[model samples]
Target: MTNGPRVVLAPDKFKGSLSAPEVAAALAAGIRRADPTADVRCVPVADGGDGMVDAFVAAGWKRVEVAAPGPTGEPSTAVYAVHGATAVVELAAAVGVAKLPGGRLDPLGSNTYGLGVVVAHALDNGAEEIVLGLGGSASTDGGSGLLRALGLRLLDADDRELDGADSDVATLLGRVSSVDRAGLHPAIARTGFTLACDVDNPLLGPAGAVAVFAPQKGADPDQMTELEAALTNWAAVLGTGYAEIGGAGAAGGTGFGVLAVLGAQVRSGIEVLMELLEFPSLVADATLVVTGEGSLDHQSMRGKAPVGVAAVAKAAGVPVVAAVGRTLLSPGEIRAAGFVGCYALSDLEPDPALSIAHAAELLEQVGERIAARRW
Candidate 1:
């Protein structure tokens, strides 16, 4: 029953380990153990990727469970969050590469049709604002599958429907003649669709999705070349320059194709999630803010959740400390990003795998150490 500095805890998920809420709760517990008098506020955040549904659910949104399409063209039941007129959906949930059998990676065969199914569900259920998190996708298609799902006709030169499920990438993209919008869902035109994009890569060029990200998805040089050429053609037929738009390469070109269809707006995923949670108002009077993620690196500054939290706390004149599983950036780099301090768990444990295996214990220690620092 004591009052100390008000601390806000906002962290992204620890990649393959803890969820954002779990990380926040563990840190908060450690902080409380170190100083029972410390006031702590726990708010989870994401960079418009995984953990989005959980974050919104923690923020009081209803978790709506339904079956959407997986990357392999099969029905994969995934969950999306809905509250009032706003609906939150993650492309990964519906069409993540993890959905492939035996973790089979298929860039050409994968599609976004299941994602479109979920979007239609949200619209039919009265959602006006659709927030689409674009990350962890396994496909490299130019969102042609999603268009097909929404009743758009993807045709070849012979007026035959292009089969996203059965056809390979070469056949699908190489044969695409035109897109028919006559069957597009009516709600698609009226609803405000926003893409939660973390990366800034456009749809084409060296930094495009194919060149930069396709390798990780099991694409060889030949596959990448073909996919790139196919994506270029798909964009040409779609009749929009979404290919050059920043963030257009996200989620296998879901950003480009979806944005082209509705003229959607792109925003930083972390900022969108924070604003959705009203995080600034929650931390306005806090003495300090604590945030972190799995890794602190040069990329973290480029729109990751921790950096986003640091921006808000710094604006409110609150000091920020981050506790991370590991760090690839120098202390100066983090300091320049407005983080006053960071605790690295990788240093605490010598074994890399053991560190992630025991991340919870190490993170709690970090929280205690951060709290015990004499202020």
Candidate 2:
């Protein structure tokens, strides 16, 4: 094996166990076990959902706390990071599904209003640009609630304000007064807005927002139908082209609402994350790159963090290895997804909960094994 002194350790959190920082620390520990003098740099990654603030903080962004609404219509506080004039808003921090109580899981009543509150906070804080992380949402309101919070009202046939869910959009049979856009932060008009999403579901169809994601949000068959109908009506009202917009189904049509109403652009969450971390530049001088996430499966091939990191490493001509919590893909699938090789923590720990509980130790051990390997 070549005695190269360069190595880059970039990994996402194991989820429910270690955070991105902890994962990097464990991986670094393992790499050092193999070569005491190796040059290693750890840049933890996130797909715009969980650990996003930490990722930005690790990259030296300033953190600010703001008040936003929770999924249950209660006031909650969220933190965002600011780098220069850009403010990073993570929807998960505002209205994540996990925040909803078990018995109160009502997709029909839930909304992205809390997310709007976060955006408003960011704008008020003097951000010139907004980078919205659209993951881990609990609403299927087609972003209507979010827009309303930002001053866009959804009026029904009698011009009364509509309630939650995209299905409510169908009740509007005519034109309504334009929302007062003047109150919006001046920076919003001049500044760019980017949405970070991993899913590719369009706004409304078989593979679109309602059909694909509503069930996960606790929608029943009837509610899903209502939601789809509302989205269709809402699309007609806005006249925004939802036809080819991929990922419109993400975050219960939050993607759709943001694009149509707010004029936001969508990008791969992982791609955005990698660029934010400046991963390519970091891995360029490294002889090897290691990345991993909670699960390695077919979905990982579809723009998840680890695969995104691997793509960057591959472009730099650095071999990438993964130490995953579990292996859900076949051997062929893993190689095809741009990983040099993969190791499962489950293989070492056996029990799922135990594997997560000791994820750091397991990752460190796997990292040691990789460092010892003569490749």
In order, candidate lDDTs are 0.86, 0.78
Could you tell me every candidate's TM-score relative to the true structure? 0.96, 0.90
Q: Which pairs of residues have clashing backbones in candidate 1? A: none
Model 2 ranges off by over 4 Å? 1-4, 102-104, 160-185
Q: For residues 20-61, could you state the per-residue lDDT of candidate 2 as single tens digits? A: 889889988987988787777788888877777777877778
- TM-score, predicted candidate 1 vs. hidden true structure: 0.96
| lDDT (Cα) of model 2 | 0.78
* Residue-level lDDT tens digits of model 1 in 83-139: 889999988888877677689888777777788888888888999999999898888
- Show model 1 residue runs off by greater than 4 Å: none
- Model 1, residue 121: what's the lDDT? 87
Using alpha carbons, what is the TM-score of model 2? 0.90
Q: Which clashing pairs does model 2 show?
A: 200-247
Highest-scoring model, lDDT: 1
Find the 10 residues in a row with the least total lDDT in model 2: 169-178
